[model samples]
Target: MRLNESTIVSASPKLIWDYIADPGNALHYMSGVTRWEVVSERRSGLGARYRMLIQVGSAEVGGLIEVVEFSPERDMAWSSVTGVDQRGRWRLRGVGGSRTRVEFRFAYGVAGAGITGYISELVAAPSLRRHLRRSLQLLKRQVEHERLRRDAAARQATPEATTA
Candidate 1:
């Protein structure tokens, strides 16, 4: 099965891309993902590999993926060669000033195990979809919150900006 979702983040595409593109920052946003860490020596850009655990039903299932494509501030795509039998990608685009459109897409198998896999996908996909939405929302909230905090600190340190 295939699933896709997107949201506009209230930040520059550069900032948002910095976060989403970093393999080490995986745990910061992904909802179903319990943990993710780089497995290879290379941590960023193409060819980076990571071992990830994603909660599926009552058990956590496979999520080890490798960076297949990486374009700074624009797009990144990864596919699991060993685990979970899936491929996923993150796409980013500038939506005017200070806003970025982010998209997440994945295709996973519903083959084998017959009705069991079908039923699991039926029940799990909805919850997984919600997790994706919330993940994006949380990313937006984190980036915006950090921006606000920085602005507040800057204004406090230099009151001239506010008064000017």
Candidate 2:
């Protein structure tokens, strides 16, 4: 099955990229994700590997996933190495004025399981879609909050603020 979701976040693409590129922040913003640990030497770029798991229905499903595509603040894609067959991508497009249209695409299926796999994919779609939507919302909130904090700090350090 394949799923795509998008959201417009009130933050720069660089900020969103910085937050999502860090594996350590997955559990903080990603809904249904319980584990996202760095399992390789590199942490935040192409070839980086992570042990990840997401709660789906009654079970946690995921495994070692490696970053197959990394385009800095633009896009990142990953493919499963072991566990559920899946490919996921994050696409960031600047929509002007410090805003970004963030897109998340995920495709997964159980190979060789025939009709059972098809049924399972259909069954899991709603929950996975919900998780994706909620995850984007959380990410937007977190990144926007960080943006606000940085803006406030910059304002505080300005010459005008200091003189006033």
The most accurate candidate by TM-score is 2
TM-score of every candidate: 0.88, 0.96
Candidate 2 — which residues are off by over 4 angstroms? 159-164
lDDT by residue (66-162, candidate 1, tens digit) is 8999999988988886766777788889889788898988777544668887777777788778877888888889877777887799899999879
For candidate 2, the per-residue lDDT at 77 reads 98
Q: Per-residue alpha-carbon lDDT of model 2 for 92-137, expressed as tens digits?
A: 9999998999999999998999999999999999999999999999
Candidate 1 runs further than 4 Å off = 110-116, 154-158
What's the TM for model 1?
0.88
Quickly count the clashes in candidate 2. 0
lDDT of 2 at 59: 98
Q: In model 1, where is the ten-residue run with the lowest total lDDT? A: 106-115
Candidate 2 weakest lDDT stretch, 10 residues: 155-164
Q: How high is the CA lDDT of each candidate model?
A: 0.81, 0.95
Candidate 1 deviation (Cα RMSD): 2.0
